[model samples]
Target: MKDTATPRFRFIDHTSDLGVVLYGKNLEELFQNAALTMLTIMLGDIPELTGEPATINISVSGTDLSDLMVCWLGEILFLSEAEGIAPCTIEIKSVSPTLLEAELRTVSVDPSSIIREIKAVTYHEIKVEKRDDHWEAKVVFDV
Candidate 1:
């Protein structure tokens, strides 16, 4: 089992949409890191929730790891776009190949602070794989 305490991911340049190449020690970490990446891209930094942090629970379903990744990030995108909520921390409690359950620690962001408006998470050029000892995924978002 990999350490669930810290997850990792990085952003990549994309011609049309936002892109990220994520790394994790395992599948659960991959999902958690992907959520962080999505939030960072939206806020243009690692978000810090001020005042009282709001907690929101999220559950997303997919048919496989790839699909689940898209769905997981897509759910976060939806919250930002439709609800004006941005997450500072994402605690993924349970994750499987087809399902994810998480608690999002968030803060309400002013509409203007949404530096990058991501319209949707896409499957274009999406791939999840294991390389050497870690899992990596390439995700693209429609802007």
Candidate 2:
């Protein structure tokens, strides 16, 4: 497929919250982009997050793709907020509407690098859909 997951995300203004729209060629790319976008929101443009890489194996599931996205991103948040780890990249091993497995390259999350605290990934306005030639996801974060 054409690699359409390149562009990252666009900011969506929310009242007392953070939001974004994510794109990808497929579900794997879409989920990967979602993690990256969440990272950006949490830490800003932290090029230094590329520090020594560590790997994490993850398997998450939900009732559907949208709920699965929430589970996926929720893991990303747990790594960052609870474990103090920041994922720099993701290699999605496999994905279906209800399940996803991936290996993530990670680094320690520096407390000082945090620009915003996302309370949670909200369900409000969350969407994942294939728009003609590519996939699109709209996600809102609770702040």
- In candidate 2, clashing pairs total 0
For 1-143, candidate 1 gives per-residue lDDT tens digits of 25555446666888777788988887777788888888777788857868999999989999988999998888888788788888888888998888899998988877788888888889998888887778899999898
Q: After superposition on all CA atoms, how large is the RMSD of candidate 2?
A: 2.2
For model 1, state the Cα shift of residue 11 in Å.
Answer: 4.1
Per-candidate TM-scores read 0.87, 0.90
In candidate 2, position 58 carries an lDDT of: 94
